[model samples]
Target chain A: MSIVVTYNKLVEFGDCDPARIVWFPNYFKWIDAASRNYFTQRGVPPWHATEREFGILGTPVVDTHAQFTNTASYGDVLSIHTRITQWRKTSFVMHYEVMRDHCSIMTCIETRVFAKHVGNTPDSSHHQIKAIPVPEFIKQLCGFSQ
Target chain B: MSIVVTYNKLVEFGDCDPARIVWFPNYFKWIDAASRNYFTQRGVPPWHATEREFGILGTPVVDTHAQFTNTASYGDVLSIHTRITQWRKTSFVMHYEVMRDHCSIMTCIETRVFAKHVGNTPDSSHHQIKAIPVPEFIKQLCGFSQ
Candidate 1:
């Protein structure tokens, strides 16, 4: 079984649109935060720290699919459940489910890559971002053994 | 031919993450705005106006899929090209392509519905949002014939 992390959020007035429902894009924002929180809760170093210790800058999403099941408004307390579903050589898949209390509000699946900085120098501003193999330490930190 | 609308945006510093690259969620934000801009440019009335005239609050996305091919940074001006690819009974599909000059940055496809307010009263805050059939006038305005 994979480890799951739940990230809680409080929907604010600004998170809604004139129609009085949470703007769809705000769901993506919360999902992204949940994605980061998943790593942090798994004892993985922050992106900046990882950049120094390892060559990884961060996990950048390459593709995403989302489905909105229910509408939520301001004052809604939502919880996002995140877990890594698959780990490939250079990419991984993350799944998220947003719940308003017990009701499922939305769901998302993202394909992300561990981005490495490649250039003439480490500090160069013109560095290229490339996908790197899933680090062994990261997989173990996330409680994956296979 | 379908009507295509191009929405231009200037990437601000705040749009980037600590990695100095455009945050993935920001692309969804811009794409949402571009979705509205597409309707506005195609002669569809704004949501507020339609709420009174046609009982439509807005088009809400039910599903979305996005692919990021390249990274973008601050100061990079992006142009989102949006168009309706299909019009169904109660839902429609919108396609968007984000481009920096001649380079393609990302692409997204969204399935959205024209949401109607349904309740005991039109002005009730507790009204339910339901999908409505695509209006004929809206189709004509968007240059769709079938």
Candidate 2:
């Protein structure tokens, strides 16, 4: 299933550089927040909660790439669109397109992995926690595949 | 000389949530750009330039920590104050504070380390490139020790 999230954003002055453009790194931050919101809105809660409940650890960024197509200033309204592109046994990927006034500002792709929660134990075996198959119930809502 | 770069920005609509708070991660992105601008203002140019011209490598983030004190919403004016906190032989630290309405909203500390640039060589030696010394000229401008 494809999930589309739209919101209007005002660029804060601190988000730009001397070149008067939104810093490249800021785009990732915006999309990350949006992704978290998207999951929460879908009743899955944050990834941190998923880890705690299932003892499955969410891997930090393994790979990330972005392409800047346009410039944004400190007061421009930006709209962000994010969708899951791929899912695997232990990993998934997401693609994001950020736009302003019908023009694409940036696009990003990110991949992440999962493992057993390594919270307190340092010598824990590196076994892959079973991937939580997309529940059929939620799949109906999200139109996602199992 | 201490150079100040001011950027005009508009808060993107996605920067705020239902509660109208600017998400936290965006603060780091702002400071990241400011720090890069700081280096450029200091004549180092972008890290990419240093890699090409001086055979110096771009530093990678080793660690980062931040404290959130206040909330900024969409369209708020935010000013970021960034400066070098410490410069060691092979590494440096930067401190950033984000402000809105003259009140601090967040503070961040980031540490990074540099190595010699090695093009297309994964195992290339970086031992030969000594740590870059802080020039006396910059010392006078920033009024800090190396």
Candidate 3:
């Protein structure tokens, strides 16, 4: 099991909809932030630095599933717990649990890939992004064991 | 089969991440809007009006799955096509296809429920929300027929 990193967020008024509950999309935004925070907490360098050294632009979500259990409104504080649950050759699965005062708000599992820019000419329309093999060093840094 | 509703969006500069692609969460935002637009295009009353007449607040997403196929950047115009694929007793499934120039960007399917406030006192702490039976009028408006 990988280490769990907690990311805290304060629900802002703008994050709510006319129904006065937190808009569901805001939960996804926080989940994405928590995803990156997991790497930052694990001493993984920022994506720009990794791009420069390893040609990894960033990890991008390819597939995601989320379940919302409890509704929360503005003025609530949420803690998103995130961790990598599985690592594949070119992708990994991340799980997140969002809680408000220990009450479960939502849970999500996402498959993400380590992406790198492909093609020689960056300006070319065919210059697309492609998933690369999971680097050993990054796996080790994130407490993954073979 | 329900009629498909198309919702258009112009990607803003702030909607992109440092990697210059549209952030994943923004996709969810558009999907949600498309969900609402589907009802509006079908001539269903807004949530506020439904709340007054039938105690229906709105449909809230309970479960969702999304797949990202391609990356999009700022200044791109996206068209999201939404429709109800399944109508359960208290919950329904909404499907969305996001496209840029007919090129698939992402697709999402979400399960949502018709929600109503469950208590008499609006200020009560236990005044929680609960799923209600799918309003027949709503189903009819959206072209669902038994």
Return the TM-score for each candidate structure: 0.94, 0.47, 0.94
lDDT of 2 by residue, A1-146 (tens): 57776645778889765444565567766777766665557776455565567644443334455555556777688888877777665556777788987988877676645434323356632222333444343334445755
The CAPRI classification for model 3 reads as medium
Q: Per-residue CA lDDT of candidate 2, range B26-101, in tens?
A: 5656766777666666666565666677655544444455565555667677887777778665567777777776
Report the lDDT tens digits of candidate 1 across residue range B68-138.
Answer: 99888888899999999999999999999999999999999999999986674755443358899988898
Model 3 bad stretches (over 4 Å):
A119-127, B120-127
* DockQ by candidate, in order: 0.66, 0.05, 0.63
Model 1 chain A: lowest-lDDT 10 consecutive positions = A119-128
Give the clash count for each candidate: 0, 18, 0
The best-first sequence of candidates by DockQ reads 1, 3, 2
| Model 1, residue A47: C-alpha shift (Å) | 0.9
Error of 1 at B104 (Å): 0.8
Q: For candidate 3, lDDT tens digit of each residue in A1-146? A: 57999999989889888777888999988998999999998889999999999999899999999999998877789999999999999999999999989799999999999999876485644336889999998899899976
Q: Which structure among the candidates has the greatest DockQ?
A: 1
Residue B4's lDDT within candidate 3 is 88
User: Candidate 3 clashing pairs?
Assistant: none
lDDT tens readout by residue for model 1, A101-131? 8999999999999998766485544335899
Q: Per lDDT, what order, best first?
A: 1, 3, 2
